[model samples]
Target: MPRRYLFYVEQNYCYGILRPIQNVLRSRGDEVAWLPVGDAFDRGGFEAGERVFDHVREAIAWSPCAVMVPGNFVPGFIPGIKVMVTHGLISEKRRKKDGVIYSFIERGLFDLYITHGPNTTTRWRQMADEAGYFEVAECGWPKLDPLFDGSLRRNASAGPVIYFASTFSPRLAAAPRLFDTVARLVAERDWQWRIQFHPKMPAAVTDRYRALSGDRLRVVDGHDTLQLLLDADVMLCDTSSIISEFALLQKPVVTYRNLSPRPYMIDVREPSAVGPALARALQRPPEVMRAVAEHARETHPWTDGRSSERVIEATDRLVESGLGHLRPKPRNRIRHWKMRRALRYYRLFPTR
Candidate 1:
């Protein structure tokens, strides 16, 4: 029997994470559609022939069997088994006080949490056992299927290409502090610089970087972030989860004051140090490259590009087995009320 699935998106970058899975779903004659939750998502990013319902009510009417979410939360009222396909791999983005990573937090909004690697699987399995309301399964992230399948190409550029990215958070973001340094480097080096910021990055900061766009430096909207990860020779980033993606490609990454600096990254302290760190990254030191390989092993062991297939299989099996073992999810009345008000969806028994 064919299954209907909904890809619930709330951010510009979530498209990359969900699209590959859509391809798998369609190839198997299953139905899939996207639902851009709010204004935060860019409608322009939607491709031709992709089905999207403008309202949450219509999505409820569609009767999807599964809802794949890349962002934090989705209305529990929506039909189907809610699956959390996280937006990014783990990185240094963490709480300043206790060094707790945000991605590990369970929002109680999902029935299934897809694990990209063993570390995540172990942690979430423990959480699942404790919560008794969700399930954790290991199936590599679908976003990198193209990357590992040997489909993406390293775009031809005259000099080494450097991808510069930053988290949107004011405290963790490196763009604000390194803007002048980046400008000077763009002026000095022939190195091709590609800047892609988190979707929520303030316009003032993005605008300054966009102004630097020209022959050598261009600001990418990050819809094609995975492509940038494939093409760039070195990644210059700060605390953003993108660091893990770039490093998974076995490329050198230059991180600025990363909370947890790993052997794979060239961690720098100041703006003045970015250039030298980038230089070192470009060199691709044997030790760092070796660490990069090991990092890939630990993060996502599957390079077969069949993670999408695995994810679908796991989801189907779970559905067939039923949710009998797991306990009921908490009502979360307050959160559900907030979601209903925000989306203006007051329908109680949403068109079963």
Candidate 2:
């Protein structure tokens, strides 16, 4: 019989990863179930969780050898093999809450933690080790598979439009200066500026920007951002993993950092004050843009877009091991005590 599997979605947007994985697995005749952990009711349907843990436990009880959850879902009670796939390369400071929750969950609960990219895996391994997680893997992020297709990235003769993948944190919105800078840029740019807001952003702010932008600024809803990225000339962002995706496209990206009232438990970099200066540089020659583009390409290296394949292979290995009940040998008592003490010590630190 095909192996049963449970896939947990932290939010609706996670369909980016979930859809592709589901497609690949279902094609192989595996039985897969999708669990939405976020507020799905507003979007359309509701997930009825009888007990808080029922959602996870029932998925486990179905005899699934492997359960894949996002970083947010805690599978502490699931008495089976578990793996977590992270979308963001969050720093410990930004993900303190997740770290704390993982501390509780990683104590012999999860067998593997899969990161979005190999570089992200390198960045997060230290923290995972510190948190008592040892079975970490650099399975590439499965979300960028669509971009690898040749037809998806053909540039228009008119040149591609600039896409702003906005993540409006309450704190960041409070910064009037950033808004003013963006408004000024929108007013000046002859090309189209498409703004894609996070679903959680307040409608009022969006309406206000919409009014200010007129025809040049467009706000989109329920659109596939991957398609937008494929057609975009440049991507303007602030500390989102979208930056990494843009890098894969080998396009120009300008990241803004100096915003206030940041998002809860998320780390963002400040955009260089030379943003306006960079705009001037953009006008002068392609040289400046070329330099920045090169840096982005170098910084992020999963451009072959084979991350999904890596993720699938890692998942298959876990499924095989879990089906066979082949976990690591039990630790000696003294080592177990030491690990317990380490968990307690990390708990003492502030959590997001």
- RMSD (Å) per prediction: 2.2, 8.3
Task: Give each model a TM-score.
Answer: 0.94, 0.70
Off by over 4 Å in 2: 40-58, 89-109, 123-133, 150-160, 173-177, 212-214, 258-300, 323-352
lDDT at 103, model 1: 73
If candidate 2 were superposed on the true structure by all CA atoms, what would the RMSD be? 8.3
lDDT of each: 0.87, 0.55
Candidate 2 per-residue C-alpha lDDT over 195-236 given as tens digits, one digit per residue, 9 for 90 to 100? 787777777767766776656677777636787887776666
Q: Pairing residues by index, what is the TM-score of model 1? A: 0.94
Candidate 1 lDDT, 1-352, residue by residue in tens: 8889999998887888888999989998999988887787888888898999898988989999889998889899988888898788876566668767777888677889999998678888999999999998899999999998887877888899999988888878999999999999999998999888777789999999888899999888647787788889999988877888888888999999887889999999989999988888888999999999999888989899988898888888777777777788877778888899988987663321
Prediction 2 global C-alpha lDDT: 0.55
For candidate 1, the 10 contiguous residues with the lowest summed lDDT are: 343-352
